[model samples]
Target: MHLVHLTASTLFGGPERQMLGLAEHLPGEYRSSFLTFRENGRCQAFLDEVRQRGFAGEKLRADFPKVRSVLRELTDRLAAMRADVLLTHSYKPNILGRVAARRLGIPVVAVSRGWTWENWKVRQYERLDRLNLRYLDRVVAVSEGQAQKVLAAGVPADRVSVIHNGSRVADFQTPDPGFDTKLHSFFPADTSVSHVVLSAGRLSPEKGFDVLIEAAVHVLRRCPTTGFVHFGEGVERERLEAIIRERGLTGRFVLKGFTTDLDRFLPWSDLVVLPSHTEGLPNVALEASAAGVAVVATAVGGTPEVIADGETGRLVPPGQPEQLADGIAALLADDRTRMAMGRAGRLRMQSRFTFAAQAAAYQKLFASLGSPTVFLQERVTCQQPPSPPSPEDRNAPTRPGRFGSPTSSTT
Candidate 1:
């Protein structure tokens, strides 16, 4: 099936990364491509890495505010490629993809990734989202919590589907002995870690970074040797920096901004934390788990799905500084517990969070949406999936083998 994936935020946040993962492994002949608003993006590294694995794709620039022109261009391009489905990430693409897909008579799926309504940008996004839902054939949320939030925000619950983002099991591997040391060199010695705590994401208010800073202060009062480093950049960098200075946390905390090579950073730390107020089955937590870094995160959005509290990682309430601090400190003070949790996390991720699994989920959704081709061989298949049973044609059991055969054994 021919498909178009669209998103305005050029930066590859968690959702875009998940999209890249799916795109890379999606089946041949399905004909999936990307539609990026900005020419350059944060996920370029991920996209490039995926391409290295061998997936052909197209990139388009939608930089202007002229919706009419952009819509015309997008519609023309989709028509040219003959895309059967238009899939979008974030609000901007959702706004445009849904509208254009309707005009083009193509199915569109809008994904709600994280906390949908908390930030100031919500109003502007809401303005663009009007009646866009009507055009969307389906609205997929990466987590149940994310789906509920979207429903609360006025989208119909019946129209939404929850599909958790999956991690590439192959991404997990043993670390070289000096790997962390080499990565630590990127930051000042003080920030490197006698006992290191790490968090990654765009530094923003919705991330509740201020709470992380506060938590760090409490963690510091008890363990002076402990230090925290946050990886990523956002609108709140200057504000977070000022808070760091005002709180006299200069030497204790490091703001590393954004980095293209996440593997380099994961090994240098003992624990990973995400104090985000909201999220969609967070990729950072999954990556941290896969890297064998014990996690300490706020219990919000899809975090609970990944973090098994005391088993895989610790979870604290969002915006509660004391609880946040306690969680971080608990893991930092006990290496035995931390390593135990980290190992558990690694195993959990490896077992269930594979890239192939994630790709399968999207493939199923796209199939149900009736996208033209189907190259993604389902985990359960004999040959081809019995023509997908005429959209929930349940009475007809699937016959799958080679991926496109109608009578092949359903694997």
Candidate 2:
């Protein structure tokens, strides 16, 4: 199978990693390539990674406001590659790729990561994306929670398949010798921070970085030696900076812009935090578990699915700084419990979320596209909930799933 993924990636982030990881782990018969919109020069990072991974990648010259040109380019490229299937990521690709793929009689699948809804402009785009998903041959929701959202948006349930994001555990198995020295370098030379609290995501309003800052104020009051570090950058930087200054967290709370080497530093942190208001199986959470670092994140989206509260990490309500602070502070005070949780988290990732399994799921989905009867059978098979956890693994208290009861698939 010749698979081509179309995306409008402004930076090489989680979704980008998932795409490359799937390609790298898939069976040899499946050839994968990537096509990205030229977001000025920002698409270079992703395209470069694609090349490093020995996959063909192209940056599309035609973009939005030039629908006809984009469709022509897509159709021409798909034909040239003889792509068997076209997979799209994000709103722009979902809207345009569907039309182009239809012109070529190729199956098109849209990977539905939850919307950020960062601003008015993004909200409008997401509205159109929700509408467009119904027409796609398939919609792959990264989380079961997101799959529900897709169903709610009028897409047939049979067309939506839930595939949880996988973690690259091998990347975090070994610690970098100089990671500690490099991490501490970000703080003041005189600062005597004993424990580091780390968080990473796009610095946007929907990510709830402001809520994290508020929680940090309370956490610092109890654990004064804990310093907070955030990775990634976006429009919310200035506002977050102003909030930091106002809270007198000058050097204490730092925003170290986007970095491709986050895995290098992840295992070195004492704890990982994700304060997003929404998510679709966040890679940061999965990566943290792979790094054996306990996370204290908001119970939203697919987070509860990844975080077995009290087993792997604690789950707090979204936008509640006091509760978030309590979770962080309580974990920080007890080193033994936190370390145990981290170990459990790593085991969970190893047993459940792996690229090999994700690749197999995709392979089944791709193979089924050739027959309508097989496709429907595949959908039914993929929708069945996961088997119950083993008795030994059921020690942790189960929290009610935010998006109804958690669902999973053999796929």
Q: Per-residue lDDT tens digits of candidate 1, residues 152-256? A: 454544456666677655655656657667555544664535788888887767888899998888998888888788889878889899999999898778888
Model 2: per-residue Cα lDDT over 1-411, one tens digit each: 899999998888999999999999998999999999999989999999999989999999999899999999989999899888899999999999988877666778899989999899999999999888877878888887787677667675556677778888888878996987788778897878888899999988989999999999999999998889999999999999999999999889999999888998899899999988999889999999999999999999889889999999999999999999999999999999999999999999998999887888888778767843443455456544234334443333323222221223422
**Any idea what lDDT model 1 has?**
0.71
Model 1 scores a TM of 0.83
Q: All candidates' TM-scores?
A: 0.83, 0.91
C-alpha local distance difference test of each model: 0.71, 0.86
Candidate 1: regions farther than 4 A off: 39-53, 115-122, 176-178, 186-192, 371-411
**Model 2 misplaced stretches (Cα beyond 4 Å):** 371-411
Clashes of each: 13, 0
